[model samples]
Target chain A: MERELKLMKGNEAIAEAAIRAGADSYFGYPITPQSEIMEYLMAQKPHERTGMVVLQAESETASINMVYGAAACGKKSMTSSSSPGVSLMQEGLSYIAGAELPCLVVNVQRGGPGLGTIQPSQADYFQTVKGGGHGDYKLITLAPSSVQEMADFVKIAFDLAFKYRNPAMILSDGAIGQMMEKVYLDPQVPRMKEEELPSWGTQGKKKGQDHKIITSLELESEKQEKVNLRIQAKYRQLEEEEVRFEAISCDDAEYIFVAYGTSARICQKAVDMARERGYKVGLFRPITLYPYPFKQLNKLADQVKGMLSVEMSAGQMVEDVRLAVNGKVKVEHFGRLGGIIHSPDEVFNALLNKIIGG
Target chain B: MDIKDIIKEENLVYKRTNVLTENIMHYCPGCGHGTVHRIIAEVIEEMGIQEETIGVAPVGCAVLAYNYFNVDMQQAAHGRAPAVATGIKRVFPEKFVFSYQGDGDLAAIGTAETIHACNRGENITMIFINNGIYGMTGGQMAPTTLEGMKSSTSPYGRDVEMMGYPLKMTELIANLPGTYYVTRQSVHTPGNVRKTKKAIRMAFENQKLKKGVSFVEVVSNCNSGWKMNPVQANKWMVDNMFPFYPLGDIKVPQDK
Candidate 1:
């Protein structure tokens, strides 16, 4: 019953939360904006504390494959990296998804066409939410706008990942990763016992146990299509059952600011600024980026005159908002790129200029 | 002698290892993979570790290796089997873990994973089948392809100036401090097959000692890839591949 409270950076909070959530292993390489995640785990020596194995991989490619190996054994495994490192992991990620394994991957965003900046950007929205690797797979992506959510979403992402037996991702940015905030650290949960391991995992068989084979390759097109259908069905269930969002002051608003992660924070401030000036603006934050809040946004589109999709990218998430609205209301996008964090006034003025004034 | 009487248990000199399943292998006739697979199965059976072993299948001809190995198996992406084996061994240190990889998988695209796993000394066995060509992809040039060796990609013969020299991975990895045992053997003959089997057993036994990587490289022949009959290919391997690859131990454990 002892709940510990501490001020920690978002990356550090994720590491601690993963241990508390009974993660079996974490394989990672050092990358900017998120190196603290692995550093915190290594310094904490979670192997001594919670029996969690922390490995510093040679590269993101190796780290993700390690996660794939652990997940195939039905272990609660995780890895974290920045943009370019995550790009290197796309192949392994696709393999993990195809094999229907459960693991967590955290991408602490940095600006990039290719290593654009060490500063935060939401440019990977298309990559994370829209099948970044290859094939018709969807990762259960959670966007954390605050340090507390950064910690909380680790456990949430893992739970959802295991629930669907699929890979999940935490999509945060450099701002949240580096920023320190109050976080409620959950008590340690016991790691799963050997007997508790999933039957489908590739762990060695005991006497009278059946041999389990974990693979993504199916040479027969008919069988492969069946697997794809099953995966798509699971994604549909996720869409129906697991859409998470937070609507602030949206009850009677005529204009809404839709964003996530750091931009969502900025949009919240902008929302207050707009309301203080009597413009009736609200903020809508989509927590789950993959099972997007489509229905809710579509419903809200009926009430609102327009919505501004603000982000730290060149208008990535705006496409999703546009799809959700489907022309029910005008959806405009405004943002800064190349690691520029927009101010509340800038976002407010964007909403006024892009949606209201012009 | 009646057929049934001749097939009686008492008359049996050898039986197929139960560690191998009833499923037919997809490997080509006279291919080295079948021989190596049988050798591994026999080793697991002899060690009484069939139920306690996990095997990683690489992404080449043996991608369907899981269908044949009657133990827990994971099929890894091309060149990522070592990393996968590292993950499994880290989680289940007491269980026997190994990766079965081809030359292209171990020496080409997955070179980083292979070298790092060996360098980390990850307490896993790596059974490398070096056929000197990309057999599964229809006789393409491989990292293990010898100088002036002819493959589909190297139809005009591998020009050392253009294609680079062949990779001697077993010798190269033996130099890494992480490796506990490294050996190169071939199965072109019954005597060599026995030696390769013994080498594989020694490699797996090294795992129980918690030593680093135990690598057993099988210098194999690819008749289909080489555009020759199985006999000719075996003869070609004996005449050519053995001189460059050599059939001997590259490293072994020094007494503590």
Candidate 2:
């Protein structure tokens, strides 16, 4: 089917794409930057047309639990919030992962340690990728830099979520969430209609069908350990098969800049600037932040002289870069904190000064 | 009667409802959870809504309630059952949705969820168990703990000036316009068991009519948590717990 290309804000694109991807329910609270998601859905009235359910929950805590309830029934459900709201959802997120439910969570991150600025920042890099919630689990995290990806990755995130029976997050930031760009949205795909609901879902199984129990509590330490080990194994598989990244000008580049999301976009501009200025600083951006692309980063580390991590936050993802590079090459970080996004010139200058002789 | 005669199929006077699982109860010998579970299971059997019922279990002693309910079940994080149940009921309005919660999970940690869910008039059932103390967490002070109640957290006896009076959550929710039927019942006696079962049945029945939230609170006993024998716990409950957390209907729909 032919798709229509529409100019959409990243937050708006997320709502539209979720509906097009056949999400059965969306429970969200009003939050800065990403509030447009629920606002868009409400105005569009997808519930009347596509039979989707859009509800403004009392809080981020309620929103995530609502998603948990519906997702436990094997439905494609989602919730979106900004950084502060995301913190409130950690408890439910932990349970959702523990119960092995499939759902989509979009975190349009703003600057934060407490109640920080309502501007774009990749400050939650460690929080989202390292499982901000309690316990040993991993969320399949995708960082979207463009409004197009903000739209496109909704379906992809839900797909990966259901495929692996794990929660998937689109780790976007306020800049991309509020920015407008051309995006092609596929036609409305009906919600997943499995011939038979997954055996794990709470769909009220009939007589003789094994009663489905969705829970994260295991009293027996031995049993809990087995479950933890099983989740760990799945994560290992994700590292091997789901590690995603984009390498720009890395084939014969001496300097490599590592970043993601909005910062990655800035690094792209820095790459162009470096090339124009007769230098060879390439950009390596990890699309999936959780899997981290360690193998790819290490291989590139063996070739490049050094790596400089450019981000909006105070050097969160840079730690991952160091771990991946493992001192194979000198790695440095430059960041504009408290929601101050660095300009292309600033990032280029940092690359020139930190990695190359200024 | 001879052994052969007594063993005849027709001679069977009672059998367990298929709605309950084979898992032996993890509850202490005198806990009210087991009886309440039986009553709910029996009601489901009589009502024939087992296949359409989805239960949200709480994070207290009955956290493993999912294992016992034969219907599809989801375990909610502490105090979020109402919100979770609201989600299920919203998505599948035709299905029977209910949340099983304890006093600590409901009145204390999850007060906001409980109020909001009811205020929205969600067509679901809420089963609240008030045992006065947190059983699974080892006799911690619950919101429903009386002013002079003694628990692990309130060892010096709850002082009204410091710890506050017991929270009457059932009476409070009765004021919410979203609630169709609100009642507080008990399961310590055979007569009370019958009444509580009736209350549970009505809660489930109202969901079929899409009649807003039906709230049922059961004042239960936790002998082990109370540090008393089963018989003494029952006596203690009737003497100390009754006046504070009285049983009977708090708010019933006019027509009903």
lDDT of 2 by residue, B77-151 (tens): 999999899888777888889899999999999999999898888999999999899999999999998888899
DockQ of 2: 0.85
Candidate 1 differs from the real structure by a C-alpha RMSD in angstroms, to one decimal, of 0.8
TM-score of each: 0.99, 0.98
> What local lDDT score does residue B103 receive in model 2, on the 0 to 100 scale?
98
Candidate 2's fnat?
Answer: 0.80
Tell me the spans in candidate 2 whose CA falls farther than 4 Å from its real position: A194-196, B1-7
Candidate 2: tens digits of C-alpha lDDT, residues A1-358 = 9988999999999999998999999999999989999999999998887888999899999999999999998888899999999999999999999989899999999988899999988899888988899999999999998999998899989988887889999999999999999999899887666544566788886777888889998989999999999888888888888888899998889999999999989899889999998888898999999888988999999899999999898888999999999999989999999999999999988887888873
Q: Write down the lDDT that model 1 would get.
A: 0.94
> Largest DockQ belongs to which candidate?
2
Compared with the true structure, what per-residue lDDT tens digits does model 1 show for residues A1-358? 7879999999999999999999999999999999999999999999899889999988999999999999999999999999999999999999999999999999999999997899999999999988889898999999999999999998899999999999999999999999999999888989999889888998787677668999999999999999999999999999999999999999999999999999999999898888889999999999999999999999999999999999999988999999999999889999999999999999999998999987
> Which pairs of residues clash in candidate 1, taking residues 3 or more apart in a chain or in different chains?
none
RMSD of each: 0.8, 1.3
In model 2, what are the clashing residue pairs, if there are any? none
lDDT by residue (tens digit), candidate 1, B114-231: 9999999999999999999999999999999999999999999999998899999888899999999999999989999999999999999998999899999999999999998899
- Chain A TM-scores, per candidate, are 0.99, 0.98
